[model samples]
Target chain A: MGVIIAKSLNEACVVLAENPATTVLAGGTDLMVQANRGMQSMDSVLDLSRILELKEWTLKDSEIVLGAGISYTDLAEPQIATVVPALAQAARTVGSPQIRNAGTLGGNLATASPAGDTIPVLVAMDAVLQLKSSSGNREVAITDFITGVKSNALQAGEIIQSITMPVFQGPQEFLKVGTRNAMVISVVSLALVTDYLGRKLRVGVGSVSPVPFRATEAEEFISQEFDWEKNSSLSEKVINKFSDMVADSTKPIDDHRGTADYRKHAVGILAKRALERVCANGES
Target chain B: MTSEIYTLTVNGNDYQILDGHPSESLLWVLRERLELSGSKNACEEGECGSCTVLLDGEIVCSCLVLAASAVGREIVTIEGLGSGNEISDVQQAFVDAGAVQCGFCTPGLLVAIDQLLNTNPDPDDLTVREAISGNLCRCTGYGRILEAVRIASNSRTVQNEEEKGK
Candidate 1:
């Protein structure tokens, strides 16, 4: 097999343009596992781990721009954690310390695993994914980026450039229920981000859907019912209603990890827990 | 497909491997080609941390790293943790605490504990448990391993203090 160690984003783009079918290797937390399991066989690989540009991140105009190569360990940094605590919280739940050291957010997005721990957080934050090809650059919403389970909207020769998300206001919470506490794939995950100033809340659900999706109806309901100034606490009635709406939005499939019914119940529980946590933190 | 020459900086020494494949994992190259079997290959999948090694001073599962991609990077296996015929403090602590049983997970646990101590010298019980969460020991039930890491941290702190006094 042919391998090219890409040193820069531009060089990697050139390689991808020339070899559109080449597998893009990031941290290899997933790809290498498939290779070892005899599940994946590749003729050529475009190694983007060494690309400095992809590993760097910048925050401008209140929107955080994270390079695709930024590892989970990097996402757990104090700087990133401060800006997007939910994303950092989601990143912290990804695998073990060793896996976090190598596994990257870009790899997670590219893999497009419905159970990807961070995908729900990205969706809740309304992350915009940037894809670059020889032709040009295009931006797609995180919800649109993931077309199906383990399938994405990335075209041939196009690589994930960076992910940009506006810094969320108010409190944000990400909760994942898995088989184990660490190094476990999420059975059902929920991310809740409340915009107190905007009087809106965003809810993103994962694992129970073909692709991670936002509970738009739930969000609308929460935004209208949640009295930020009047209500001292999250009402149980509101929590139950919000959870039901979030659960209703998901189309979970029964797999070996969990059943659809269980996922629906778990999603409601997670959504309620996340919303409760966010409410407990007080405003802003 | 033809094999290519891959050079890795292992334990501060450079070794040139003539039969490295892109499909081959770093764990395979380390154990088979370099004969560094300290890092066990319990699970080729990243689910198990038995093949844990330090890549550029950060612990990562060697099984998840491509041999071809490891070129020019620094890698330290379990064998690199100790000097000639002398075990590391963490290893000694494991012995003292009876953390070793079947010993299949010892090497990876030691590497993970060492890295954890290097970054956090005084980790609490929860920190130690979280640090070694990836490593699985079917025999010890994690009680002795946690004690071993605590002992290692205590000894290391004392040593550092003594050095400061000297």
Candidate 2:
């Protein structure tokens, strides 16, 4: 077993190109846990912690590009929270202070867990991932990046560089239901993002599916029903209908955390509450 | 399975890990190789904060950190929090508040509370609760632990006031 600590992106890419099978270690929040349990083989590892470029985030005009190495603690900072409140909200609900300090956004994406708190928020925001290899770089939409449970579309020799998302000037909310209040994996999570400039409302649902996914049906329904310009209140009937659509979009399973029926029911309630909070013009 | 050699800077001291494996956790290296067992190993996973340590001054689960990956970074374990023969203010507060039960979770909690007080000396009850939410204690139902944090925060405030008066 060998550990190759790369101080730069170019160096890491070269190593990956030479050995595509080398396990990439960012924060090691997930990888190390697996290694401790004998579930992961650390025969060869490309440590990306020394790469400073991956730890910095840039706020471009009307867009935010976050480095994959940006820790959850950094994500909850005032600068990031101001621009992407849902992402920060989700980041706060992550494991713990220790986990938040060590876990990186890129690590969450690379792990590709369906229950990842940040994945649904990224999906709702229409984020895109920049993947790089020694050969070249490519961009993949967040929705397409996560292929399935604990799986991603990252090609061999490629590393996630950064995530880019447009800055929406609207209320965005993320809600997660876990077994306990803290340090528990999400039984079902939801993100609701309103894009006033685009005249669109996007909903992302997680944990209740093989992949965190955007609820296009529910989003479309809410976009058409809600009065965006007036910021009018949504009636109970409309909210219930929208919530049902969000619930209908999930593919939850019966696991230890929760039952499929319960997940479906809970996600709908989350959707209803989120809609009420975001749309009711401060009534909720 | 080959052993590797690496240097880890812990608590202002550099130690050479001669028998370190690439996959070994910082927690393992700290307890076994360096013999700094102050950072407990309750959960090898990140769920429990027993293995919490300061990596580059930020709290992180040592169990979730790769030993080799932590190269060239400053690490502060529970053992490193105080000066010679003198327990830190947080440690003293824990004793005063009777927060140490079974003593298994004390080391990690002390490290966490010390970090919290360093950053926010006057944290509110909610902030204190949030700060120690990661460090779970089955004993005392957390009332004494909360009291310990309050006591530490109050003492720090008093110390600051005294220095100001000087």
> What DockQ do you compute for every candidate structure?
0.72, 0.75
Write candidate 2's Cα lDDT for A6-90 as tens digits: 9899999999999988999998889998999989989889999889999989998999999999999899999999999999999
- Among incorrect, acceptable, medium and high, the docking class of model 1 is medium
Query: Model 1, range A1-284, lDDT digits (tens) per residue?
Result: 56789888888888998888788999999999898987776557889999998988998987999999999989999999989888899999999998999999999999999999889989988899999988899999998999998999999999898999988678888899888878889989988987777788899888998889899999999888887785367678988999999999999999999999999999999988888888778643
How high is the TM-score of chain A in each model?
Answer: 0.96, 0.97
Report the Cα lDDT for candidate 2: 0.91
Interface RMSD, per-candidate values to 1 decimal: 1.4, 1.4
TM-score of chain B of each: 0.97, 0.97
**lDDT values for all models:** 0.89, 0.91
TM-score per candidate: 0.98, 0.98
Q: Report backbone clashes per prediction.
A: 0, 0
CA deviation > 4 Å runs, candidate 1: none
lDDT of 2 at A254: 98
C-alpha root-mean-square deviation, each candidate: 1.3, 1.3
